[model samples]
Target: MRCSSWIRVAVASALLVFTASAASATLVVPEPSDGIEVLVSSSCRDRLDVSLRIDEKSSPGELVFTLSITGPGSTRGDLRGFFLNLADESLLDGLSISGPFVTGSQLAANAVIGISTGYTAKSHRHAGGSSNPFDLGIELGTPGISKDDLQTVTFTLSHATRALGLADVSGQTFGVHAMSVGKGRCRTGSCKLTGVIPVVPEPGTALLMGLGLAGLALPGRRRA
Candidate 1:
């Protein structure tokens, strides 16, 4: 086989491995049978909408997440605290968060907020009242992601011991607390939201998979 053929094979092999390791997922409401509950009242439910997306980072043991909390056209509120569970409970000790900022995708940028983490969910008022004891707590500061102003938060999570992937967080429970719920029947106070993360296939991964398979199929030239 020619040197170029070997190079092509090696490159393709790496691409396959890299793409396979990188995964993505989104959060969804868990079913009652799952023993998870949303503490937000029925009236307040419409006042707050929380959505989170997770993607594998280029570096091993790291993942990036975008969390958006919004309300219906008439409803509005603020995100106060967020909570979640790790599939591997042991990862909690080594878990670290970075780059937590209000995403700049919106036209008018929101205020710069602070991010705080607690090992036990009970440390937060919202998560403490929940049925599930979340493993991690993320507390945001005042003027938190304003639902009326359309704001979102983005951050990265890294583990010290293991290489992180979509599987690490997929199907895990997540809880969110929003305050000042208004614009409807909801009283002016707080609401708790809980859900599970679901894995989603990334288009780029599919493309890389195809390219990798093609490269591996390439015919190698033989020396005469």
Candidate 2:
């Protein structure tokens, strides 16, 4: 009878731990389309690299997502001038890109491509003095993302401008254009941007799981 009780407790505890570990994360971009679009002085030369961080409470190493970029057929420009910054600041930046994914005829009907990067900025070209707002479209794959994980992305404009030499615009303000998908279509709207989200375990849930595990272990010890 004692052995059976111990086994039951152990099994229950293991189940609780497994469930807790499998808890889902959430990602939210609480803004309307028409996102943000900031106009930096022509003096800004460095291109911006973007990356997204999911679940700040969880190590960035644990969160992964596939990123792709596409553009309207009317959009014709060389994206090689920009790159993505994927360093320790993964939570700060979205994902980095190097070289143009679309060119000439490839820019039609919107195309998508994948991107990845590590620490430090990879050498790339800086936009010239020309004040052109390049329109780059992004798409994120939602296979493993959970509904509870906190998600935020950052864009780091690294490069020197003729006005500001070797400037790192890590915290500089920029405009963002917000957009959303509904009924299998995308729409743009004016969005009020805010700060990033923090992720952490629920205190009550953590406590309960801990106690359950302890109870199971105690029964096993007594049987021994």
Candidate 3:
């Protein structure tokens, strides 16, 4: 193959990776199930409309959550990150749930160093009401956003599930009791933003996937 052809392939691959991992649509936050019995303060739940999901079929041993707000999103503060105390840790994969997964995508490039100071991994919280410390206290980070803007963030947990130990993880139930977020400077509407990323195929990915696939059907140059 010609060098130029290889270059095209390299560029194509890079775009695919970014397209696959970059963003997910904003989901309306769902209400916790009565069976789960973990009570996140009503005030927190009221602050933003949210939706949760556990992607057990498409991805196994991983919990995928999309928390979003409708219309103009809200801002409570600087809005660093969000958290949920695990009522049960058995759902988490002990080894795979750390590093970049802990921090937001913006800082994932330097996760190892970013985690310690950037945000809390799995720790204690009293302000929310003295929750138990973990085997699965997970925190997900976010790239900062403007107050009252439409924005959405998706969390892909390495090893978390809701089939057992709690209510079934689904649209009907979240299986969580407590939740919190870090808003360093902004408070009381200082930093809060939410929205659903539209589910349309990105133009770049569409062209790449479409043209690239069509290219495969055509003849290829023989190796030198």
Task: Note the Cα lDDT for every prediction shown.
Answer: 0.46, 0.20, 0.29
What is the TM-score of candidate 1?
A: 0.53
Query: Per-residue lDDT of 60-96 in model 2, one digit per residue for the tens?
Result: 2222221111222221111222222222222233323
Candidate 1 segments whose C-alpha is farther than 4 A from its true place? 1-42, 57-60, 100-123, 126-129, 143-150, 184-187, 199-224
Better model by TM-score: candidate 1 vs candidate 3:
1
Q: Estimate each model's TM-score.
A: 0.53, 0.18, 0.35
Model 2: weakest 10-residue lDDT segment is 1-10
lDDT of 3 by residue, 1-224 (tens): 00010100111112211121223211121222212111121224234323332333444455455434331144222223343434333444432444343443222211211123444443222211222222222334443344222233455655322333212231121212112322333433322221111122334654555455532221232121
Ranking by TM-score: 1, 3, 2
For candidate 3, the 10 contiguous residues with the lowest summed lDDT are 1-10
TM-score, model 3 to reference? 0.35
Residue pairs in clash, model 1: none
